[model samples]
Target chain A: MTEKEIQVREKQEVQQAGEPTKPERYFVPPVDIYETDEDVTVLADMPGVAKDGVEVRLEDDTLTIKGTKGGNGGEGERVLLREFESGHYLRRFTIAEIIDQAKIEATMVDGVLTLKLPKVEPAKPRKIVVQGG
Target chain B: MAIIRFTDRPLFRNPWADFERMRREFDALFQGLTGEYPRQVGGTVYPALNISEDADHLYVRAEIPGVKAADLDISVEGDTLTISGERATGPAEQRFSYHRREIECGRFSRAITLPTRVNPDQVGAGFVNGVLTIILPKAETAKPRKIEIKTQ
Candidate 1:
């Protein structure tokens, strides 16, 4: 069997119109979103970000995920070759109303964050017999 | 009296900014000199590397999320360091419809040439938060030595 090579992607700098307050550069983390029968799952890759540095917020149908990474390399050490830059991770998605906001859960492991948003169950159909008045 | 000597190059340096300009020149010069082209002018290489050096050791780091330590393989042969690993996701039991699939999971390997010779026996590595850091001690022959001045 032939082995597949994972393609390399440079971190993309986040650019939002009319939002100039953020001075430090933030990168758009690559994510995978999937939906099963019960809930939707989101997996984002944010390396070098510890558990305390990650924050997930959901408000007004918008879900935002942020991760901050500290500076790398030691003092007095000179860089020889650099192929990537360390920065904060930011991404936002518009969540549907069918999701159950109270049951959303998030967990991070080895710099990858996994979020689960459970869908609201639809009301079951009921049969009713009306008594003669 | 102790004599203090300063190097010619400035201490505060940013090499990445210069590398971008130098890469373009080297690409153009190589194409002009030889009809065959090397790698792409501006393209992403797999498993991006950040190499840094101090007086004693050289550090190499790579960001590889969702890769387990058991799946990774690292080797140092002479002046070449090879990093290979596989990123495995959840099992294929539950089939779910994907809305947006950007993260790719597969096997990848990259070999880097060290700028200076290193002692392969004394190399060390660690993985934390999906980032792999490797420390290689410089060989004795490659380290700088100061000569003593003798007056008769």
Candidate 2:
């Protein structure tokens, strides 16, 4: 075999190795995190997401937020200027020990999903009372 | 005989000043009314508002989606505050083939006249996510004060 043929064979192997076996499309929702004394709020911009269309599920140690876009049953030929197309979003976050799994609350309003996670009572600071000696 | 379409104008009218006064009243009523959000955008309408109190500081929050930090313009004058930004749709050819478009793309300006005077020297603005939050501290005299009560 010629040296050029060996080089071509090596290049083919490298290209095959780089290609993913089962490619999965992932969507990352833009999130804004804010912390106050009471709890930490996470506001995620999930446009075109409806309450019934969204699926918030927790499995094992991963929390997933999935949703379908444009479910309003409006079908027509219309011109679109700018598009924000997020199809079947599936975002998973590894659950941390600091998060209160049982008390997690999620609400969807105006295509914005807000998740309120209250910290555990033991994790919060408590004011100590001083007694007069 | 030819029939002419009768265009009946007002028989009697008030003077120019009286008409101006009525127009002002109508304008005030329209200005006080709450405006409805544009239905084309899928998200909620975040109106840029500047709020101030006689006793405390002021805080302003503006809803600007699909707008980057570079597109914002904020200015303050005395108690008047203004926020202007543009949400461009980019090149026309690039946007012509979009499948679904929900976000609004255009120029938006919101001007608010604060109820109470604020300290112009201490004004701060920050943008996070798509919300623009502006903090304005109150002047020394405008802040809340506690007066001592004497017991005789």
Task: Give the number of the best model, judged by TM-score.
Answer: 1
What TM-scores does chain A show, candidate by candidate in order?
Answer: 0.89, 0.57
Clashing pairs in 2: none
* C-alpha TM-score for every candidate: 0.81, 0.38
Q: How many backbone clashes does candidate 1 have?
A: 0
User: Compared with the true structure, what per-residue lDDT tens digits does model 1 show for residues B13-59?
Assistant: 67685886687568547754553222332336578887788988999
Candidate 1 lDDT tens digits, A22-109: 4455889999998888998999999999888899988878999999887665557776776777778999999874788889999888
lDDT of 2 at B57: 56
Cα lDDT for residue B88, model 2? 53
Q: Under CAPRI classification, how is model 1 graded?
A: acceptable
- DockQ (model 2, Cα): 0.01
DockQ for each model: 0.41, 0.01
lDDT of 2 by residue, B28-103 (tens): 4664353311123332223423232323556664445446768788888988888776665433433233322333
List residue ranges in candidate 1 displaced over 4 A.
A17-23, B1-43
| DockQ, 0 to 1 scale, candidate 1 | 0.41
